[model samples]
Target chain A: MTSVADTLDVLDQAGKWRAAGKGVALATVIVTWGSSPRPVGSRLAIDDGGNMVGSVSGGCIEGAVVKEALAAISDGKPRLLDFGVTDEQAWDVGLACGGKVQVFVEKVE
Target chain B: MKLDTLHALATARTARQPVVRATRLADGAEALIYADRTEGALSTDGAIVAAARRALADGRSTTVEIAGGMVFLHTQTPASRLIVVGAVHIAQALAPMASMLEFDVTVIDPRRSFASDARFPAVRVLQDWPDDGLNAVGVDAATAVVTLTHDPKLDDPALEVALRSEAFYVGSLGSKRTHAKRRERLLAAGITDAQFARIQGPVGLSIGAKSPAEIAVSILAQIIEVRARRAEALQAAA
Candidate 1:
């Protein structure tokens, strides 16, 4: 889950998105393996308009996850997604070791 | 923001999202519109609003901050559940403690007398065999499984299933002698030494706890400690 500070920041962002009439989905990392940057409980919130908040899987794969979350909301299908940053491309997400993560993204509705 | 009613209405519209409202409990709370609001109290309005805004923005959980005190608004995000495969005395106490920690606790036992609601009023007590109940609930990393029944017939099959699942913490309550027997049985069942290590036999902390409540406390303490350590390690790795 995101921190109180981070949660508030994302909520503020979500509020703005809501005022602008954007649909938002929240993604939470429920599990991780092998030197993952973020804890299993880390969270990320993405709006239908592509605005984002929170992080899961450190910085390695949040971009991709956010895209998936936005798409899930638009499509009205919640999904559990997984991504891995391997040692060969460890620097791709600025991760040192090969780490894999599983995230659950669902629409608030 | 000065209009509590307007602010409450605005927040209620977005209540579907995990929202936390930090309001000044000591002062400046006159602007708080919802008397039904779950509050995070802070000393000042600035700090309270800042904290409340932060919790709202994250859409993960909520926190309310007061100057000297902070009340965290934990929006009820679904957390992992825990299933105990025994209705032993320790399970009686452990179930409630686990529930208090926010785990959806369920106890399974084939003995109707052992798994009664009166014994564990707060927990979901099921008078069924282990495998059936666990399969129904679906154990995973989010779920913690513990076998408190010393009987091999009760614990063995349940443990076998738990070993195959992604349950983060799988422990059994027993003595050294019982664990040795269990190890031998697991080996016969094709479990490797590595997999055998997965079971936290002789469950609970090293603290010498004699009573059922004490044992429950120790066991829950270990779970909390392990979870906290895992979170820290993940953060450091990040």
Candidate 2:
């Protein structure tokens, strides 16, 4: 489980990125099924430059999520993404734990 | 997400108050909802505020469909606290173990020699009577009180305060006969039998714990079991 300090750090980083005029997006693990690495409510904050804090999926699909988060930042729209081990590219990203995860990515306005 | 609202959320977290942050998915508008009041864009709407309040009461973060869009309510509750009312050997072991479990631990003892910082390095040590120490610390629902002194003068006063408060766990260290006598004293002191039943005498899981460290492990294990079971029940109800 993530400590309160960790959660605060993610929020603090998002605030700092926004203050610096950097486009920011927040990705949260809204739902998890089976043996997903991170629990529901885990967060990852990403800035325009792809700098990020925290983790929504313990490094398994973070790269894909970050790519989507950057798109959300540009469009100022929220996107809900679903990923599972059944996907053909799951083995390439290391999400072979036979679990499904849904992440919500939104611009931190 | 206004800077003022963010500041208020940080302040509430520092003060250990239950607070919820509701973020609207459509426009990214945010609100800070406290037990008494709310601050920000979503504060004025009764429906959103009520939903946030329900999330806070559930002590979990969740998404709810509102009028215009879906809002994610991130509920943050205060950290769990464990007050060990006796700076004894078991407490020395128990305090650190409890800290590892993410509990804010405080060791209390009236004896200056025992309650010294040297004994409880990196732990909050209170050199005062049990009742006074507990009062200063302030017991609440997220708190657990354990008396290890085995002395009536020390353990009884602490139990009196703990039994009356909303502490989730109240434990006392003693054998069955000792607990029997302690029960009589508590009954005479106006503690009802129903309330007295809350005290876990011989305080620790019966793991045949022989050493102080082993006993501390057992006690911490029991506390975790109780907390997990309570959370499971809450989840089931929710």
Candidate 3:
């Protein structure tokens, strides 16, 4: 319920940010496999100023997603990012439960 | 995401309408897919729209490899709800538990004291008559209704309303003998046997639950089982 409401908030605020001349990027978790903190379709929105709403993997990988989302907002390029426990940097930002998540970060036009 | 697509999503959310946003992974092309209409760059793709419909029904996001490219269908559906018709002792245990499980829970009873916010600290409490409370809440396919009041006067009205609505689950707490008597009364009130059969009597799974908390656990488990079975059947048919 909180996730759904969070997404609703993201959509609503994204529109406001876009209208107010602020760049915004939306990141969505498209795939999740095993023990993921958030389910598939969870979202996180990042503004040009680094403000964020909603979550993709709760707290596990949001920092990385926000970084990529800010880059997407800057470059106007969409990115399909993947994070798993198997990655070399997994120790730094990997899921504690060893789940895999695929996120699509796209600039909101 | 285009401005119009975002607006359409906000519109769909407000209406509680199911939606799927299908994104082509090859390019960043996306489409807002509703049952009757579509918008965005890839709106003309029939295969993607069909897949989107399937994902919407399944209430799951999926990645499908189509002929041209892989597409991710992200689905959004209304939240599931739980309506406890009697703010009784069992409901005191059930309401918060259901809320914790992410069901929008509401406790309804004509007795003000029973349905007070003090009784149900977190869940919504409605002191309206059972039927009126149900009407105010508005039952839907994503909703589950449970009649926890053992009194026929209170439970039967709620049961009659629930049995007629599109609520996915309807259960009433009572003994076998009490259920038999209730069945007769409902039958006399013009409720068909088919409709009456929808009520799960002596509510909750027979897990030898002794206390109110255990009974609440059993009931919630049964609701989850029923919903999962229904979803499996729907997906199989689809």
Candidate 4:
């Protein structure tokens, strides 16, 4: 688990980005399964326009995750996004593994 | 009086570098400072330093009474960051493990040939001189600076800058004798013995590492050990 100080650092930096009029959303990987790209507690930050500062996966499902994160940012709501490599939608989303991953998307103020 | 004492207590607990909160024995301002840095308080500098040092050494969180007030020091290591001043072979192996260890790794070197996406795909590689590169990354208490160039023209200037920064660990890849000679050069350039003491010569622990990757592992291992030992010491003090 990351320390409060570290999390605060990210929040503080994100705040600066937001102050600069950038759209920033915080995406946290809450769960992962076999062969998942990122472990739980991994974070990927996305700006309002969909520019990514970090990665939630090993580049496996970032495109889909970013879309979800962007939607959450626009709606000012949180989203729980799940993707499994075995699902047909996973193929549509370009995931190549049987492992499942869960991401929580929250827009940063 | 309560607020004053609480501030003192917090300062006392934080002198060693752990994150601590001091609740006044009576009632007053809540003084929060990292265990390693407790300043702007009266009559508690020594205590804060002692407490922080002890808490950091222990690597655990604790609640205690300092100057008759309750204070808590959390001896958790901040995410370690590695600032490599050169993009050499050793850095390639070192960067990934450091990432695995949760270190925010940044490689800085002016040589475009050495600092390229192909060489450091997973790490942030900067094609700038060490001085400018380090400034961009913003060295702090949680950062470690390693000079791997072995060239005085490059390593010396880099060491000169890093020694003055807040980076907790500053090591150079060289033998002790080499460091001794390097010290002479630094002294000529106005770096004092006290400042020289800040550098870790012979870089990593005496692990007899031969290959670049092995040496990189040894270096990071030493960094982690130093971090852990600092936590332990702080815990004991608390």
Candidate 5:
């Protein structure tokens, strides 16, 4: 679980990125099932160029979430993405422990 | 993405104030709410603000149904604070352990030799009288005050202040007999039975703690127990 201070730090960075005219996307763990690495309410912020801060899955599904976050930034739309061990490619994405996480990615305007 | 709201939240976090961030799930509208006031524009309704305030008091994040939509209230509290009222041997062990547990620790002692940076390298050491030092730090519900000095001159004054404060935990190191005598003295000094009951005499969980380090562990365990129980109660209420 991310500490409250760490979540605030990510939010502060997102604000800074938005102020700097950089497109920013915020991905938050909205739900978790089984033995997910990160708990619900963890957040990750991604800038236009894929620069990111914080973690939603403790390295288990950050890459996938960041990809979706960058996509949300470009499309200027929100996306709810779910990843779990049931997927065929789960081992490649590091979620092979029967855990599932639902992330909400939204553009920070 | 409101910079003003984020900045205000950051400032509150820096000031160690309990605050909550309420975000509308549908549109992502955000607001910063404290006990008495709110910043930004999530909603102007009193119900939303009141829910946010309740979340802040509970110290937990939860999704609450409001009039128009569901809002997620993320409550943030300052780091837990531990104020050791004596720069003693047990403090030497306790400070680091508490720091590792994310407590902002302060060790106070009137004796300069004991309350030196040399003794507590990375901790805040205050060279002042016990009451004066605690007064300067200011205890609240998030703070735990531990008096390690057995001296009545130091520990008694510190206890007098701590028992009256809103600190979640107030503990003093002494034997049962010592605590009984100390209790008599405090009663003579006008401390009531109810107020004196708030203190954890013998200072720690009875886990056969012998060494200073072991005693520190026991004390920290007891503090954690109290803290966890409080959180559970709050969760139940929420």
Candidate 6:
């Protein structure tokens, strides 16, 4: 379950990283279509060192979202990313069939 | 996401206040919305604010297409509360389990020695008597109250308060005969038949549980079942 404590833990980790002067980015699942393992508001916090916590599409799309988050941290530009079997990358990591998600990555300043 | 916004959200969660994070899809511009106030440029936008409030009411997150762009409303309400009205051995097992499942667990007992930080390290241990403790915790629609202290002195008062309030699950630990006696006593004390029926005496799914830990598992499973059914009913009504 995506409980409140999980959200607090993720955001607190991001805050701590930012306070420690580590560049941090936050990735949130803004939309989910057919059989998303995680819900729409699920989040992942990524630090500049490539350290990550939490999940967006459980596992299939996380590696891709983390890459976007790291890039967002470097450039300070937000990105809205999409992944599923239909999209390019096809996840080939396998969302397998429909399970599409729209993830928004933003730098935590 | 701004640090101050993140900090404010942490503060709201600590305070158990329902809050919504509104993000504009076109730009990732953000705002935090509380029932009484709003925290960013979108504060002036009635449509998004209303959407955020609706999100809070249903305890679900969603995306809304308002003019200019799309807005995502991520609603975060306090974790559901579980008040275990005893610091008995079963509670020692149950409290941590409930906490692991993200319930804000509270162990209430008048015995300070029993309801101590040593016993319930992860959960709040309230040393107040049953009635006082339940009132202090404040039962709501998301709250679950269980009486694990078999003694009527400890369990009945808590059961009375739980039944009168909106707490979604009211369970008392006892045998079938014991529960029959309990029903008689509560009826004498003026609890309605319908209200009396809400008490799940022999409280647990009939899993043939023998040990305290096993019983705790059964109770937790039953609570989860009740919560899911209630959520489905509420969604259907909506």
> Which candidate tops TM-score?
6
For model 2, residues B148-217, the per-residue Cα lDDT tens digits are 9989999999999999999999999999999999999999999999999999888989999989999999
Runs in model 2 deviating more than 4 A are A1-27, A33-38, A43-80, A85-98, A105-109, B1-7, B41-44, B234-238
Off by over 4 Å in 1: A1-109, B1-77
- For model 1, what is the alpha-carbon lDDT of residue B216? 92
Shift of residue B102 alpha carbon in model 1, Å: 1.5
Q: What is the lDDT of residue B48 in candidate 6?
A: 87
lDDT tens readout by residue for model 1, B95-145: 877866767688999998899887877667888789888988788766788
- Give the Å error, residue B81, model 2: 1.8
Q: Estimate each model's TM-score.
A: 0.51, 0.79, 0.75, 0.50, 0.76, 0.93
Kindly report which residue stretches of model 4 are placed more than 4 angstroms away from their true locations once superposed.
A1-109, B1-78
The pairs that clash in candidate 2 are: none
Name the DockQ score for candidate 5: 0.22
Evaluate residue B116 in candidate 1 and report its C-alpha lDDT on the 0 to 100 scale: 84
Model 5 chain B worst lDDT run, 10 consecutive residues: B1-10
Model 6 chain B is weakest, by summed lDDT over 10 consecutive residues, at B40-49
lDDT of 3 by residue, B85-185 (tens): 88899998898788767677889998987878877877778898888999999999999999998988888888889899989999999999999999999
Report lDDT (Cα) of residue B167, candidate 1.
82
lDDT of 3 at B48: 80
lDDT of 5 by residue, B115-165 (tens): 998888877889999999999999988899999989999999999999889
Per-prediction fnat: 0.00, 0.10, 0.48, 0.00, 0.12, 0.58
lDDT of candidates 1 onward, in order? 0.67, 0.85, 0.86, 0.70, 0.84, 0.87
Of the two candidates 1 and 6, the one with more favorable DockQ, higher being better, is 6
Q: Please write out the lDDT profile of model 1 over residues A23-82, one tens digit for every residue.
A: 777666655788778765466768876767767765677777777877877876667666
> Can you give the lDDT of residue B12 in candidate 1?
56
**Number of colliding residue pairs in each model:** 20, 0, 0, 31, 0, 0
- Give me candidate 4's TM-score against the actual structure: 0.50
Candidate 3 lDDT, A1-109, residue by residue in tens: 2322333477878988899999999998888888898888888888999998878986989999889999999898899988888776555886788999889999998
